[model samples]
Target: MTTSPRRPMMISAGVMAVMAVVSLGGLVFDDRILLGAPIWLKPFKFALSIGIYFLTWGWLSSLLTVRQRLVARVSAVVIGLLGVEYAILITQVIRGRASHFNVSTTFDRLLYLIMGGSIAVIWTGTLVLTVLLFHTPIADTASRLAIRWGALISLIGIGLGGLMLVPTSQQRASAVHQVIGAHSVGVPDGGPVMAVTGWSTTGGDLRIPHFAGMHALQVLPLLAMLLGFLARRFPRLRPDRTRGRLTAIATAAYAGLVALVTWQAERGQPFIHPDGLTLSAFGLLAAATLGAATLVIARGPAGTTVPEPARHTEMAR
Candidate 1:
């Protein structure tokens, strides 16, 4: 197996991790507001998440045998663009202003443009990498599911974030009044929060689904692998069959959860304040998933008996 080009990614992760820590340090000293949250806070958190994301994906991507040149090119370009995005976000932090959803001044708009373009490049690179990954002969079924599902689910998260970028009625008003493309749907982005994540408690926050969906890349694969490990521990169990079914079950549950959060947000409901309808929907999903799992588990892997060659001899004799 070709040793993955790991050094470059290791370096990138190290640098970004340092930056995230530094950004955290900046929060204590720099007192500025971009929306209601501290300017440095958003960038600091984003750096932390994106840094981890890159590192995790880097390790996972190494599992496959994509063209070294293709991997290098995509990694370089994506990492570079992400760095630029971090730079712009940090720049806004220092300026004591909004980075995303900002259209107040011409310069702010230009910064938003650059940030958007940079993200577009990064996402495009991610898509390209996903396509490349599909063609490769990933060793295990569990890993194949992880690579394919992770790439697809992560893109959905990206799409949710893109949806947040569009100007809604409230966002349009906010754009004219303060910033453009607010993440909150019914209310402004900076509205009352639930302490952490800055997701609005007072009204709809589009970030909830976006956040949930984004991490599928990490979660689904881990779940699948864990199931595989557990199956191996059980001597009677078939690892391949169990892993596939478990992965399918997990993916369905995960997708339902993401969609549920999106639905909850769209209705201007906070994460904690899901009404009867939400509960009902969730119950239905749970029941369906349970039913599917029950059937798959009971059926197990099909057992085919190979016809003995001795039958022919017996018949002739």
Candidate 2:
């Protein structure tokens, strides 16, 4: 496939545009008719956003093969998950149960499973895709090695995220929180403390666990950047390093911020601690580990180089 550099940018822009519009619409109709519009409509907006995100991936995958194909496959899994979620939501709407977000009932539990499973699939697929997509095309063996190590660290972050999903009692609570203006689990003290005082069910705090896991996005990507940077700086590594070091630094900083936020949430306690301090602490540790791992990857030795599959390799022999 012909890779068009501009196509990815365009698709990204389009997704951003749609997200902006939806956000604006939500803001404009705050607490008004639009805000209270049929519950089904609300989820659709999110579904549309997810759809756009997946479409962007599809377009990007079409641009190049091999690494791009890996991305496309991962994206397909994410899209499939989103599609199932959309269907379930549509069913809820048709049944006039759109307001139900808790998984107290069998149907709700099934919905939660679908959502959580899909998200997990997307997270794992994304990590694999990133490794294949970001390897340095022009580099010494060391730089290529750094890329592999970086990818490995990122996978660790992904694994940590999946682990967090093991405790998913608050899926419904999270959904209701979205419907209402509730505070997220583990938010730091300072603002008006909001709690899930009345959720569809009473169980665990899904929000905190999910957010903690999602922080891997920054953690893993930053580690990748660090690897890329080390490969460039060391003579034995790659010669033409682009934004590797800078991205690594930025990602490390972002991970720190995520940790701080997680800490704050822990301190805030009762308000953010739907599952209590113990769970929140677990999240904090995970985020901190990700940050620490990023630093380590940044400073680690550049490993072995892997060849970038040829363009024709993406198509046929």
Candidate 3:
């Protein structure tokens, strides 16, 4: 009844912290393998990711100046849905069954549907919080841009998860299995994979972009923080406007990266095995980002613009 926006989310994050530790232990001690990796691996990764996400939202909730009651209600709903998701995932892991994309039995299908539905609702809840941020004023320009753009991009990232739900051509072709979806493209799920990520090595893996995009919530804000810290040493970065411009550039670049990886994955290309076209596209993106960043730094502070020369010499002309 107190309407404290941060408490529930932070508490949820704390629970995830404990779960992460337990899941890590399970990874080491338990010999059970789900799909291709250790059964506990998915739980461990999800625990860490969800913990960080909730913690970020917990902090952001404090920044909201208006609509305390509404914020609290949304926060509660998001947390509750996350709990549902984790419960099903953990249960499946314990039972030595796949939590995601698994419809091997009636029970499995029901659980998967519940998990998917919960995630959709959770994404919608986060979107409402993000829209609220636009109305809530923050004094710092860099931080404001970081939070807004980060949240928007994070929504895009979260939306990408839905892409995995679509059945691949192979899945459609094979009538022998009940599994409906997969993270990997151009190859089956239980093939050779990367280390702890379990991303397919022989084909495209949507998780690469999904992971990169989702973490923009952390990355963009951290960039703003880093710029703030460096401003103490370098006066060029001392201006709020300059810092804001830099943050905006970084945000665009980060979004571009998410797009690039998503494009690469859709083409059935392994991240480590990029062909010429992918490399060329990435090169262009990097060059543009660096060029824009340099221009921003050269502009100096907010109020002061770079001066034009009074007279043009022959060489200058």
Candidate 4:
């Protein structure tokens, strides 16, 4: 059976609306709305948000044939699971209940393994979906390129986020302490006493780097779309080998730049240490690979025979 094209948009809109309401309500009811939520509930909320986003994508995927739909659904499930796992771990950290190895116990280890596997599955599944969609009939080349690039950037973000999970030894000197000491944010007795910061001890700061890397998927793809639109004025530049090559080069360079930033973040000492650099690097590498692949795709001769569309009883209007 086929699904409606509008469903994805509808779901996305609905979820976003709900989230807005929830956020607003939290703000109105509690001064510390962010801190007010129960530890476990926080992850659930985060998972729900991510799940909704992926679900929208899955809903969009349903616009394809049965096989494609199956792939999309499976991918959505994996993404949803990863979202949930992320939420849980983050919540644990927020609650100050997390350990170096939260998955030290057998059960916890199993769960962690499952979550890790789900993440890998989601990444692979999304890439496969991207490839499948690339060949499918679409209204415009720009949209097609947008989708492909979006998927590529998303994979980069996921890669970076994953890398943040890898543990590293802390710097002997604490940057946080130094900053607070130098600034004299508050001093207890003799000299500047190092304030005990909760989040610093945990991996909360790592989120910054992960988010920066992931955001590129949104930023770069939108920029590409804008470029594609501008290129319309210049007929000669449109849909050519050179443009495609340039796109590849630009994307690769963008990824490489992100990697450099990630390296910087990962190299810092103490609280002054750069967080998210490693993850950002991983993200950039993933994007670079995708860029290389896109270059290969765009370089092929024109007028290649199209693949047969998988059987669909009815096509969405």
Candidate 5:
């Protein structure tokens, strides 16, 4: 079989997908709970997320030159690190203990050390990969911009996750706390849970921006591509600059939205309960975003047409 840059990532995705299924099955068969969730549920969600991440990262990496061996090695490291984390999480769950913030025993402390170290490595690898992609040339200007910005935003989200461990005002901060409680703000961690995330909906949850920002890698690229498609259907916007500009505005709005929500959460405000001031803030942002989008997209052929960007040179596998 021929080797390719995407091969390692594809393999990682497949393996993680299988693990996701196993964890899902465990949810039904094992009947266990640790830290307010069915033990397997954490692994199930994580496995699926990792599977998708590998697939996306692989695709993005393939776009860069010299991506083959370098990307493969990085992918290997990432997969290995994630695997260790998954194992530790599952092990702790099986022991009916929380995987994170568990300093209860020597074994738990060791496991925590291992997990934290592995995560640090993964974060560094991701940052390195993002930097490589940012420098790589892509003739498709909008796509290149999208990928770079997406990766940047994703890194910010990862950094936000690191903040969760800072031991500053952890929800329900108390004596028994091994570390910081990652959830809740005005209230405790285990109190009220939202449907999907099981995070406290009534309190500030850092996961909102963490969730939105991480997906920028996926969302921005896809949105940029969609604008390209739309441009084709509408000849008036054909200069490519229009589409590119529109994409940029949208990306800015997306970033702003994440920031706004994160700030709101930091204030210990429930996402569901936005006061008038919050509503006004959101409205202002929305209006500005829509106005910017309208200005860019409404331009016709009469508008100054920028020189068409060079066509993308597909990276050879």
Candidate 6:
């Protein structure tokens, strides 16, 4: 079998995917509820998320050329740490206990602390990987920018999880503090929620922005792929610089989206119930993104000359 840098992460991702499927099955048969959602729902979500996360990182790590050994080691550690965190989360879920922010028992608190610590280390490892990515050279401008911006934005998204750790005013004011943090603002955790996602409909939910930001790792790269595909049909999309610029604009717009949602959540506004000001902000962001995209397309090559895509040297397994 041909060993590759992507192998381990891909394996990890597959395991998570299987776990997600199992968790989904549990949802149907377990008939358990926690924090106003099905008990297995959190496990299912985490499993799916971890699967995708590992998958993305697998592809990403395959692209690295510099410091191969170091990157692999760091990635291995991050993946292992995530495994530990997920184990704890699933254990809590199976026990019908809240995985996050639960301080009901000393054992639960210790498990929560371990989860937090593991993720902190994982985040730091990801930072190292990001730095290594910056140092690695890629000939393709569009792909390069996509990878860089995607990684940086993902870090921002992951960092937002920290906000959920802060004790809400309600948690602080209550005489008996069972939970330290909350996912919702302007309302308690267990309340009227949106379908499937369980995001609070009555108040702002931090997970919305956090989810959007973290997935940039895939979104930006997919955008680059989409542009590449479109280039065959449109001569104006032929230029590499044009695609790179477009990716930059998209990254900025996406970052703006993250900021906008974060701001909205902080203001205690539900995502579904955005006020006029929020709408205005969104409109502005949309307009600017559209304008920038238009300008890039207009300035792109009028000729249908497709240049060979830049090739990145893959790291050794």
For residues 88-186, what per-residue lDDT tens digits would candidate 2 score against the true structure? 755665454532334556776677667667766766675665555454352332223333443444444445444333322354446443232122333
Off by over 4 Å in 5: 1-5, 67-69, 168-177, 300-317
> Residue by residue across 1-317, what tens digits does model 6's lDDT show?
22455789999999999999899899999998787888888888889889999998898887777888887788889989999999998889778899899998999999999999998999999999899888877665677788888899999999998999999987888898789999999898988888778889999999988898899998988888787777777877777777779989999999999999999998889999999999999999999999999988887778757546432212112
Which residue pairs collide, candidate 2? 102-172, 145-303, 145-304, 186-265, 188-264
lDDT of 1 by residue, 1-317 (tens): 43454566777788888987888888887776666876677877787778777876677567546687777787888878888888888887778877887888999999999988988888888888778778876545555676578778887887788877877775455425446566776776776777648788778788899989888888877766565555544532344555566677778788899999999988878887789999999999999888988787677754422234311111011
Report the C-alpha lDDT of model 3 over 1-317, residue by residue, as the tens digit.
Answer: 55787888899999999999999999889999877888999999999999999999998888887788888999999999999999999999889999899998999999999999999999999999999988887766788898889999998999998889999887789977589889988888888889988888989999999899899989998888788777767878777778889999999999999999999999988888899999999999999999999998987763442223311111111
Best by TM-score: 6
TM-score of each: 0.87, 0.46, 0.93, 0.53, 0.89, 0.95
- Which residue pairs collide in model 6, if any? none
Residues 204-283 of candidate 4: C-alpha lDDT, one tens digit per residue: 23333444455554555455556455545544334444344555555556566555654553443123333575556557
Off by over 4 Å in 6: 1-4, 304-306, 309-317
TM-score for model 5? 0.89
Sorted by lDDT, highest first, which candidate order results? 3, 6, 5, 1, 4, 2
Judge candidate 2 at residue 95 and give its lDDT: 55
TM-score of 2: 0.46
Cα deviation at 311, candidate 4, in Å, is 29
Q: Residue pairs in steric clash, candidate 3?
A: none
**Tens digits of per-residue lDDT for model 5, 1-317:** 22555777888889899998898789889987665667787788888778878888888877866555666678778878988898898787778887876676888889988988998899888998898897787766577778888898988877777655656564355666575546556765666666656666678877777777888988988887776666555665556566667768877888998898788878778787877877898999999999998886676454444444432223222
User: What's the lDDT for all of these models?
Assistant: 0.74, 0.44, 0.87, 0.47, 0.75, 0.86
Clashes of 5: 0
For model 4, the superposed segments whose C-alpha errors exceed 4 Å read 4-13, 27-66, 79-117, 134-146, 170-209, 232-246, 269-317
lDDT of 4: 0.47
